[model samples]
Target: MSGIKIIVITFLLCLFIINSICKNDICINKSNGFYADYTSLNCQTFYFCFNETLNKTLQCLNSSEPIFSTYRQRCIGVNPLYDECYLVNINENHENCAWFSVQLSTTSNLTYHYSCLYPFLFDLESKGCKHYSQVQCNQRFEPKDACDYHHPQIHSSIDERPCWLIPSCRNKTNGFHGNQLQECSSYYECKDERFLNLTTCPKNMHFSDKSKTCLITLSNCENSTKF
Candidate 1:
């Protein structure tokens, strides 16, 4: 084979490999809401663009009213958890008395169930209430100048209170800071967005997506698979 022809073939092979590796689907540009997957019409999910990371997890906020919005990539009109009653609690006897059942399961002897009160999401892993998105908060209650008992203190326009009331450590310098939160001996870093130590959890412990804390329990970290 001629040297020039060999070079051309090698370049084409490299291009093909690059295309296969970097599959930046155009659907990534869609807004941070529920969108119907073109490949699977019946499956509607949400997407979140955190900086350059495209989190394509199918988080169906409202499973009951699973209606796609007419406007754009939005899913349902609003998150149903925040509509009426808020505060889901299971008694010691494994009795749930919440308006909606966020999670329900049963073991050999004990039954486990988690419920979400208004504006709070029932985190199945943590078995507690986690703060919902700002858009979800706005659905039922308007932004208030003064913080209320149920609502978290509004530090800034972009601040949405995370679960477990862990402070958003984005204020620190644009680098890594170890063990910022004294409660959990986990590392913290500041970038485009700031949260908790997500890179690694303590020995025999795992990070919780609902609370954003290092939990000794393994089941709590199921949803936080990336970390």
Candidate 2:
């Protein structure tokens, strides 16, 4: 063979070998039969193998609504001391609740039974209490105010009233210098403190020779003008 043809044949053989190894490493076996690629949607990472009798019980429950109730009594017969068995309602709105039961039971001993009554099933995990009637997938707790009693406060807005202090006279009054009241509402000293200027002072009012402070005196000048 020519040197160029030999090089091309060698490259083709190498490419074929790499492709074969890639195909073998990616194959995954799903429970529903077909061998799928690892990245395929049908191939899940987790698997569980229940008892054959339990598997048959679940299969019967999945088929019909009435069979779930009938299987519950039969389940108790299989294990009278069964700790958990729940009856759940299977309506259009309560479909997610049914799915939740199936998902939770994958790792737990809880068995879901279907019913037409107000409470569809008794949850064995919750001490035979009824599961939530309806499941809201994205339901969230949004309280109106920060002081609401039910939900725990996780975060708060900086603009909220409880987080800031409002400017007011009650927090402003500091002390009196001679007869003049020297009041301050802030933490910093006022630079331009003068009579009738209305300067905002800090905790300590700036006093320049005490005369700059204002005095509130009782006025009787109308009766005794000359005095």
Candidate 3:
């Protein structure tokens, strides 16, 4: 065969090999949009093709997973801390409400946290992120395993109450019961009608009033304790 004929045959063979591999391993097609529902079997590699041409090869970073966004026409990382949640309008129609779970370190302990995309809240009961109106907002303390804020400021007197972040304490009426003291947890209570008081956790530790326990930090209270 002539040199030109041999070159043409080689080119055709290369094209056939590439087409076969793409057809078997990827979901991209001629009619595919900017992005396609294509992920590697390893779940850590993905690709973005433009105009039927492989444009980019992206690898998942850290603990993030690689995903393709049909709306964005690209590859993205589903990072817990930096992931964006899609927002639903006030009407609460059928929409995607994606959320990410993040691990955060407080002064005392390591805690797992979840953030819903805009206008959504993480539902503990459902174990899923849902629309704000759909979720039944907990008006009470979280379970003992969760991390919650502890107020550390010193009050002027026993009559003066500090403010914590739990919902039950916020709803309690000041001086409703005798001495107006409702123990939310061993380390915290509702006092002075509208105020919350921390009994054990110091300024440096996070308090879990539900378990009546205090999370200790290296800076101040070096050990977790119960009052």
Task: Specify the highest-TM-score model's number.
Answer: 1
- Segments in model 2 whose C-alpha atoms lie over 4 Å from true places: 28-32, 35-227
lDDT of 1 at 111: 27
Which residue segments of model 3 deviate by more than 4 Å?
1-112, 140-227
132-164 per-residue lDDT for model 1 (tens digits): 342223223321111221322222222344444
Q: Per-residue lDDT of 160-187 in model 3, one digit per residue for the tens?
A: 2232232233344332211112222224
Evaluation by TM-score, superior candidate among 1 and 3: 1
**lDDT per model, in order?**
0.38, 0.27, 0.37
Better model by lDDT: candidate 1 vs candidate 2: 1
Candidate 1 residues lying further than 4 Å off, grouped into runs, are 1-28, 31-33, 36-64, 69-164, 180-184, 196-201, 204-227
Candidate 2's residue-wise lDDT over 1-227, tens digit each? 69999999999999999976654433222111122122322222212212211111122222222121221222122233332222233222122222222212233444333321211222333322132332232332211111221112223222345411222222222332221232222122111121112343433343332343422323211211000
- Enumerate residue pairs that collide in model 1: 86-117, 86-118, 87-117
- Least well predicted 10-residue stretch by lDDT in candidate 3: 143-152
The full ranking of all candidates by lDDT, starting with the best, is 1, 3, 2
lDDT of 2 at 225: 9
